[model samples]
Target: MNSKYQDFVPLKAIPFVEFLINEHNFTLKIVHQRETKHGDFRSLPNGKFQITVNNNLNKHQFLLTLIHEIAHHVTHQKFGKAKPHGKEWKTVFQHLMLPFLNPEMYPMEILPYLANYLKNPKASTDSDVKLSLALKGNIAAAGKNFIFAIPQGSLFIFKDIIYQRGAKRRTRYECLNLANKKAYLFHQNVEVASYQREYS
Candidate 1:
């Protein structure tokens, strides 16, 4: 295990994470938070793959995002240019996540939801409302709010932008951007602040 990343993931996940980093020979970057994404993987112009995970995530979310990005790498290696969140990537993500899904890596409160989510993982963990909220519990901050937790017609702030939460559209919540009046669909688990506060 690399001591350098000890603070970023559960102790039990360190060695496996390190092994993936070493074996894949790709760059893993812990970057500042990006409101639109938790992590991403891309092949660089220099002919190397780089995976970046948001620095703000708690250990559990961080590990999940890391493995999620790694699954992309593995999927690409196996089936070049496969659909981003297609069956190939799903299988790879599930297999990679299995070793880290134990209680040692995640709290008991999140296990059931996490297991349920892995049964058919989505492109973003946020797509799994229960699992996303369960993981957010590990964050140090208190009184965290989510889009789905707020009442419809309520004003909330997300990514420093104000929006009025609207009706549910299938899985995501429809929201009207206060500034542009443009409608956008937000994942149910997207963390948001009350109209008066700034969360991100």
Candidate 2:
């Protein structure tokens, strides 16, 4: 992992990069963008890939985009870009998302979303979880509001939620409010101050 990623996602970036190098034999390149974009592609294999991560995004978002793009790279290496989020891409997503689902290894910055998704990805989806949790007062705070119970990892969401998901869970969650809106969680907790507070 480079210093840039270290400055952003100090913990997961290295492990994620190692996963790419060892498991996929790929290198990571970070690029800052003018627009609020959280990682995109440039080239691949013979060409260099530019992960245009959203500088505005928090450490958790940055890490997620980085991992997501890396997963894309692996998918591209294994199967050239054909269909968006194709079978191979989905498979890679599954693999990457699986570990985060594990209790011992999950990062705190990504827990609420992961927990909701893992518990009932279809029912308790990220958005749904954020909504439910936010409604319950588990809101995300700026700066170091995130904390990892695991001393080594650098994220807050990993500590709070269990990663194990049960069968007969929803594969997707529906959030009417989330749709047609621009909202994202801060440290797995919803940012509600700016938006209307859904006081229960």
Candidate 3:
């Protein structure tokens, strides 16, 4: 776990996070990416606790996800069966994240957004577009562009589904899924595959 931590977390954050994992006796599993989530925590029937984080996340997101799951574990030990991202979890998550909000643990570019986010962190950091984009280093597949960067009426593919971009409704963009012809809201930072073609 010590060596694995080096690969997944920022250099300055390794020691503190290692302390939390060892103190809790958790089994941290770096698994393949799951589109719907960055990480999760669960208790085994055999009395073991495991936290799984996607292996593909960048170091900043990886550290955030690790602490996020650790907060879940700590919350469970204290609150027992509470709402997954309810007040209890939020409080625990905020407290656990406070220490890592520093320049040493995070980059200057990401720190401000992170500090503001931890004030009332959501179930996913992707909820904050500025923060999410910063975590991504504003980089995507060379030719791909963020959903927001494309014009309305343009076509884009996400998760293999083709969506036609629509108007901005408050924080998210409204998009029509070409397959089902149903509307779905997309985060501005969502990177959609770009290509040129004619579609009816």
RMSD values, in order shown: 3.0, 11.9, 2.3
Error of 2 at 161 (Å): 38
Which regions of candidate 1 are displaced past 4 Å? 138-144, 167-174, 180-184, 197-200
> Can you write out model 3's per-residue Cα lDDT over 1-200, one digit (the tens) per residue?
35668989988888888899999898999999998999999999999999999999989999999999999999999999999989999999998887898899899999999988888889999899999998988887466899989999988888877888999999999999989999999989888886463222
Q: For this target, which candidate reaches the highest lDDT against the unseen true structure? A: 3
Q: In model 1, what lDDT does residue 142 have?
A: 47
lDDT per residue (tens digit) for residues 1-200 in model 1: 55989989999989999999999889999999897899999999989999999998888999999999999999999999899999999999999999988889888999899889989989988778778878888342445487777899989877778999999999999999999989999987777778755544
lDDT of 2 by residue, 1-200 (tens): 34445666645445754565467554555555443244665575666554556565555555556666766777777788645456676667667766544434345545655555434333112345453343223544442231211122121222232121112224321122233343222333222222212111
Estimate candidate 3's RMSD in Å.
Answer: 2.3
What stretches of model 2 exceed 4 Å from their correct place? 1-4, 10-13, 21-27, 33-36, 44-46, 102-109, 115-200
The lDDT values for all models are 0.88, 0.46, 0.90
Model 1 poorest 10 in a row by lDDT: 138-147
Global lDDT for candidate 1?
0.88
Model 2: ten consecutive residues of lowest lDDT:
146-155
Candidate with better lDDT, 2 vs 3: 3
Predicted model with the maximum TM-score: 3
The better-scoring model by TM-score among 2 and 3 is: 3
